[model samples]
Target: MRWGRTPDSAVTERDDDGYADLRSYAAIGDGRTLALIARDGRVDWLPLPGTDGHPVFAALLDAADGGCVELAPVEPYTVRREYVGPTNVLASTFTTAGGSVRVTDSLNTGISGRLPWTELARRIEGLEGRVELRAAVRPGTCLGQASPWVHETAHGPVLRLADMTMAVRTLGAEDVVPGDRRIDVTYVSSPGSRQLLGLVGTQAEPLVLPPAEELDAGVDRTIARWTAWSEAFSWEGPWSDAVRRSALVLKLLLHAPSGAMVAAATTSLPESLRPREGVGGKTWDYRLAWVRDSAYALTALFRFGLREETHGAISWMLGSIRRHGPEPRVCYTLDGELPRGALEADVPGWRGIGPVVSGNPAGEQLQLGVYGDLFAIVALYVGDGNVLDAETGRMLAAVADLTCDRWQSRDSGMWELPETRHHTTSKLGCWVALTRAVELAEDGHIPGDPSRWRSEAERIRSWVEEHCWSEERGAYVWYPGTDRLDASILLHAISGFDRGERMSRTLDALREELGCGPHLYRYSGMAEEEGVFLPCSYWMVSALQLCGRTREARELMDALQDTPNDVGLLAEMLDPATGALVGNLPQALSHLALVNAAITVATTS
Candidate 1:
């Protein structure tokens, strides 16, 4: 069942000026970090040591100064690539006029857990006639102003950039030359010939090259681990393959040691390819965990009966709140600490979009919706026959109390925009949190003032019904005084805030106003600002199902699944005009929404 590359016909290179479309890249991770491999046999983006660590390969953002690991045919060739079944291993087949060869790529992992060292394994197998394979490993200082050099070891050559050191090993290659910033090697492979190349990285430590057999075995072990994890998934619903693949992608973004799920594997990947004064300049890092995104991920995993990931996420959130306080920050690092302020890198952004940013300033923003997001995870966990500890119960009660105190104030909404207003979605998010808190207290799972929480929840609900609904728009507006539609309201339909004709009418209004084909913008006037918000599109699918439009829901699911990259990975957003993926890659929100929407379609249909 492994999706091995079998050469069927010749492939053609499709790149616009050497820059691959964002949709043309597939991802491979070892639960610690991830790398984006393009269709043309290039490792474009990789964060070494950790998911939130500095970049070693960042060609996805800056092709010139950013480093990359490339293995491709010297001549123009067609390519076909896919992941090995139920695993993150990628096999890409390159076919030229003379011959075809298949290259297998993986982030090697240990059998028990993540390996201490970062290893990237590329196995090239000759499939047809003779073909020349060119390979190179270039190291960079994560867009920082540091120089890289090459040093020779007894075994082979090593590339070093500042604190990071990479050991390069080659098998079945000839005419290898080690350069200052890159290592170049070449080999000719005919039928039945094979070659293996490995790059292992360690920061501020002496390099230890594992034996050749051990490195080879690492690939098998990593594949076996991923397969075992996938097999254990308890989903037997429609779109099962896609759903399981989404779940696996979500698992890849999880920082296993800390149980924090990152929003994406990358940062500062521009939301648009073209530069438009203010809009094209919008790019932010997503390597940290947002409470809202994590809550959605936990809910999705819980739906598939994945207790381990659910508990891990809950434990991480609770631990963070206990350490920092009951007030929620917009996002936290993988280690549960507040992220430092954003830093503007002096590197050309993706496709020359300037102002490549690291870290995120959104950490300081007052995102009021997070209260509901955090509690929603707790409610789902307890509802699934799990018990909360005494400390967690007290934490929940405190958060609910804070929500009651702050629901009347204005703050940044779910989109995290700067202009603060009375966001109707934020109000309802508190409503959801308080409502769930009351239910938990009533069920004796938590210690809380249920009567007070219920009263506050009802008060918020009444306020929303009174002021947020727009008679002219025939749906709930983003806030009062503006007839703008927001896709975030669709989440309430999933939350059971209102599943009656009112929500159905809102769905129709959102579709008519905010939707472009199967994709949806976050709010009014956003099409010119950014790409289509991907999670909002999936939210519509769930909303349609809630409204009894089962056929429409299934159709939307099929179309939305088609939007992923060739390897079944979704970015945070997509270009409605060109269907190109935009924003940070392998986004957790998009994947989680997809999983939930598929389950909704399955259960409703």
Candidate 2:
């Protein structure tokens, strides 16, 4: 059914099984973890401390079996909700015939912004007249498995298990509803009074109690802190408001203390439309950090003058690389452990999307572009006059040396597919890594084998020109043996590997093959299995800028940006025919590409 505050032109409908519209879930997190809060005042997805931690609540997977904490008017009422200020603290108003009540939801802030200890507090304030209130505290199915017991304690109700304990408090409400894996209660409040419902985690330890007054102050302090944090951003351009809102959302996704950024706040929101039957496997856990994503994320953070955050990400990446050792892993846990394999959840997936997956399989894949990504980031800082220490310089040289030797070998490429292929884009990535290596060496920022890097990068260039070029199509192919037009070639052009006639020819070829309306797909007429990639369109915009095709780049960017949701959140892909958002929602890579492409266009055009 149509509900909550959505864009004016948006449409909503209940599915056959009476599911709420999936789009109503707004997200809040402490950077290391995330929670999806629905319009009805229920939080569905919250991992306790780390992104890979067992979820405290997981209604995002199976609504009935998955647990949630809900607050609302006991009597029938209309609902309205919005974020309080620029913060993730959400205020939802319940209006009954007698009066109205506004309940605010927030994850408590640590003193002066320490992290890993999470507390979610809800407060209901009566307005105008007496309003009846209702609450249900139910938790089940953590880490894709259901919980064992639902207990009613002397103080309050508790959901206890091996790993999680959520003690909840309700004021002006009685536990009237019986237990059936769901906790329900109702009460009445008069005007000029208030009630609080607090959900705090003990992490299976004895509950530590913070007094009601302190908890309330904590909530207020949190609101103020986020307000102060948001003011640091200064935007002066078209779509500033939208841009600011997006930037704020992104900031909320960062783990404040650790400075590690998550790719998205929700997992398995689905990347396809085929799973209308609710089979439960489409959801992929995105809470963990990806090297590629962090690389791009740091760049965006730096662009906005959030240098501390960028440095934090840099530290995390470097530490993870060191821990993982000589071969850098593609993705890792927030705590820097390499994930084992994909986990299939037992719960029914969101909207019939089968197999809500936990832990990424891509972690095991061999993606060769990471070296290039790392080098590009480090070189950017060095070019800005930041000095690289001797160890960091040695690491950069080692990475470049690896690139020189391995760029010719077939790998998974940027997409991390199952098959290893001679990917043209990946070879170009090698070119970028080596080229930056040469730049750093020449600038005296690092002691690298510049001559070797230049010679090796030229060897890769010669290989691409000889084997990857398509005489029939007059543009570079996706792989050595394939004539398919892949959108990744746009990145090759934008990276300054081939910016002259070769780039112009590839640009025309990509436009002819990959362009769907104003946006460009990752490849031409790919099968359903591969999906339509949106980031490639962003790469196209950057390529256009690098090639002096400013008008096309601006036009394409404007058109592609319209695909994001009302909150200016972008998905992984968009269907060419129906314009439906496909792939994962709120993709960090897509947004990073957008921000960087905008910067490129502004500086160049």
Please give each candidate's TM-score.
0.96, 0.90
Candidate 1 residue-wise lDDT, 128-247, digit = tens: 998998998887768876778998877777888878888877778877889877899897888998788888889889887876556767788888998988887789888887788899
Clashes of 1: 2
Residue 392 CA displacement from its true place in model 1, Å:
1.3
TM-score quality measure for candidate 1: 0.96
The TM-score, computed over Cα atoms with residue i paired to residue i, of candidate 2 is 0.90
